[model samples]
Target chain A: MKIEKEPISGQYGKFKIDGIDYRVYWEEAGQGIPLVCLHTAGSDGRQYRALLNDKKILEKFRVIVFDMPWHGKSSPPENAKVGNYKLSTDFYISQIMSFINGLELVKPVVMGCSIGGRIILHLAINFPDKFRALIGLQSAGHLDPYYDISWLHRQDVHGGEVCGGIAYGLMAPTSPESDKFETMWHYMQGGPGIFKGDLFFYKFDGNIGNEIKKIDNSKCPIYLLTGEYDYSATPEETKSLADTIGIEMIKMKNVGHFPMSENPKEFLKYLHPVLNKIS
Target chain B: MFKSLIDDNEKRSQLSIMAQYLNTSFMISTIENEYLVNIEKGVVKNVEEGPFVMPSYVFKLTAPKDEWLKFLKHTPQPGSHDIIAMLRRKVLKFEGDLHPLMSHLLYFKLLLASLRPVENKNEN
Candidate 1:
């Protein structure tokens, strides 16, 4: 499926939630339940435009996606203090709760990627009753050994090398459409510092893991989805997370981080089964 | 001089065949150990000094032209696949005929498939 650019209707528009101006970008399609889509960090809801506009997905449910603070057309915080450092998990959770409540959404299925996935985990833990189902893509809530070390050194030393590796390494083998693919690749990057801060929040101590354990105790059902070659989070770590939380985890082979962007067809094939179970 | 003429004639024919088959132009920068292939209008231009060890993503070229030329100071030996591979990875960048360039890029995989050295079963 092609990624089509759709203009956002000011359904929710810019509203203040606890002193922060939040711009919610949303489009409603199909009928059934409302699905709230949270994009990866540095990415606005635009990343999910393809999924939102998909004929099959649109036929099933109404999709709502909003840009997180400091991301995509969303208003920056009133205070630069919050902007100085990365946005904390607590800050994000508060914003999400406000967004949901402001929109009057009824415990919609929460789906997120990377940092968005982490937010879903937090939401599930703190506010278990808010969502009917949870979908985490290449999620970062798991406590992995590799995640303990700060990538600050790599950022300082490797810089663009690591950036290029993580960014371009995800694409499939070269095809005739390499140039077009390159354009897409350039657009996918969250610039330099933005991505660094995003990763930092993702690996912030064992907060996410601790939160997940709480979610397990609360008996919140969550579906963990990821690609095979997702170096950021290994399959072993994912399996461990599933075993720890006793939740179903589906691994898509021949893919990497951002599988939805890389191979949406394969992603949907795996995603539909879990979504069906939830529905 | 007579031998050189025969060699040039053979080389010209060989170059034509290589161009038609590969559909890309290859340039190698030895200093950076990078090779850049210019594919214009679905045709591969040069094929001899490539397939070298370089960073991937041919479109994101980093080296400047002067530095690249300096890197190629010494005459390059023939039959270096590494240079072409390097070019495919895009250590250097070039601008040429757009249509042919795209054609060359699109047929990269096919060109690579065909360019594999034939196994010398008789020798080894």
Candidate 2:
């Protein structure tokens, strides 16, 4: 006896956040508390498309994922005139705040990867008692060792190709060819300078090492699941942050920055434990 | 021309807010010598011709004096106008972090293009 592949799907909509009408393209499944997922820089909610369709996880939590402005199907804010769409701390927060309020979610669990992971710190630290829990993937209190990829902006080298190439080095060498291409394919669709704009927060604005002290664990429990292959925010870096903030840290092996997208099946093995603990 | 261009608070503020290419500096080098241009939050603080104490820059863009003069002309020829064009043509050589150079492409392009003297066709 054998089972065939199951088709994955999602529901989508649009919502206004911070005076900007963002086209919210998202998927939701199962029942329980809403688990809002944020994506890494350059890429979009598509990064979590796999998780949204996961059966076991879907059964326990209502999964949600949306693309940021200037990413995926979402429209950029009016302030984004030409190549001027920069993401600020206020804007990033407002987007999430508005989304949560818009959907009328009840103390939803916010999970993010990379810049998504980075912004959760700001959300958790500033809002404090707002969200139920924060699951930061490839996150650090302060993301050090940022690689400047400006040279890749030349016409000779396509920005998307360059975007995909840089991320290629970070993923596990043993990852499936299809999975790696799928992850790289998302990056291949990044908007001009969008990657750099996100890094501004990932590297600087979101580097709230000292700010983490302000966070009260009782208000929102923080769980960091960093990828071992993620040099940008390695396990060592996340461990240091966990040790400093006194939160739980899990080192995800054979995966890089985009765990949910890279090896979702293998990633679930590590994620299940954390989800159970929080539940 | 450089002074007035950099002094324009509107442009600087716009660049800072829109691009957030803050606290970044680079050296523009001609065959004659080098000039250190330091910008903080998009405001140009200093532009001094180099060969001095503790000279530093994120990236150094080098070209011959004549080529620069030609590139900075009212209308530069093919492969002489843009920095990337010049680099592609091997007319301009970079000596440092290319990230800032490429990342803040427009700012630097405008900064260099600002060197073009305001043309007054009727002037004798």
Candidate 3:
């Protein structure tokens, strides 16, 4: 039988953040400038699979993706209680820093989407020197809750399917069917209440309205890329954030909330230029 | 038009796997019209146009004709792209029990999305 294997590698390592032991799983491909990609809420590092395998991007950047604890292949902390996964700003920052320090990455360019996108702002404001550049996909200072998240973790509902269903609408209708479904599949596999737990940080704990003003773009240049169809983090929201911070917002057409995963080909078209400028 | 499109066998087969256990009815109301759709075990049994005094449906989704027109476009604008988007923008009103809708969200979402007009390939 003929076999074809991807040019990607996966490894699991132990990281201690805030005195908790987490067996984190990460995937890496390519070489050159270090690029750390953070996935969306309730999803995992698999969101960056298309980016990790792109030949052109691989030629210029060493792309790395890691699943946060309680997500994907990364098991929750051994000593933790069940269904108690709440992400706080300090906890999120410490985890990223620990992961970077553990991997010995020096000033890697940090890029994140959705909740991951919001965290990059916190990172920029708190640890400006840690990253070479900050890229926020579907990022905004705050998001108003649309639907009752109580449905997400309720026993009466199928958490995974409902979660996937909610995210399905966030993609542009023009995106390829296979890619859109794949992005939904990630949400479908999320643990119970995990999406809502992450939202605790997204909707409430992680509001950066006041702190965003402190981020000096000259020191750690901030780039915001928002999909036009992302209702959660609409183009208006990103544009407002950009205007507030005195930076330009790049609006991606025919894309939506989960740009990297839902329409990677379209996303790369917007990304390549930014990476070239960063390089 | 909504009835014939949703009741197609191929369309029913494309619904989410969880639809197999769903047996519910809902109403879709545009500004000037209302259509009551009945589903039993994932199959679209019937769709009836209505001005009934008190129609029986688990839930009702109401949106203006213009909003529905936008939603039915082959590639709708951002805020009109999906039910949730419209709900977020307060353009679509969802009334009645949400349990059935939220429990089988994928099924309902796909069911509604299937109504979008198919693009014409020969357009100049």
Q: What TM-score fits each model?
A: 0.61, 0.67, 0.96
Candidate 2 vs. true structure, TM-score: 0.67
In model 3, the runs with Cα more than 4 Å from the true position are B121-124
Which has the greatest DockQ?
3
Pairwise lDDT winner, candidates 2 and 3: 3
Candidate 1 lDDT over A1-279, as tens digits, reads 999555334354777767757665565555567788887655566667557666767666778888776666665656644325465776777777787788788968888877777777777777777788888887755433332123322333233333333344333332123432442443344434555566566766324645456776245579898776555655556777677777768887655556666666667888777777777
Q: Encode model 1's per-residue lDDT on B1-124: one tens digit a residue.
A: 0011122232234334323543334443344344555544434333333446653333332344443332232221111122222333345344333223232332332243233323433321
**Docking outcome class, model 2:** incorrect
Error of 1 at A42 (Å): 2.3
- Report the TM-score of the second chain of model 3 against its true counterpart: 0.88
Which ranges in model 1 have alpha carbons more than 4 Å from their true place?
A1-12, A79-85, A142-165, A171-192, B1-124
Per-chain TM-score of chain A in candidate 3 equals 0.98
TM-score of chain A of 2: 0.92
- Which lDDT tens digits does candidate 3 get at residues A1-41? 87878878999999799988889999999999999999998
Candidate ranking (lDDT, best to worst): 3, 2, 1
After superposition on all C-alphas, the RMSD of every candidate to the true structure, in Å, is 12.1, 16.0, 1.7
Winning candidate number (lDDT): 3
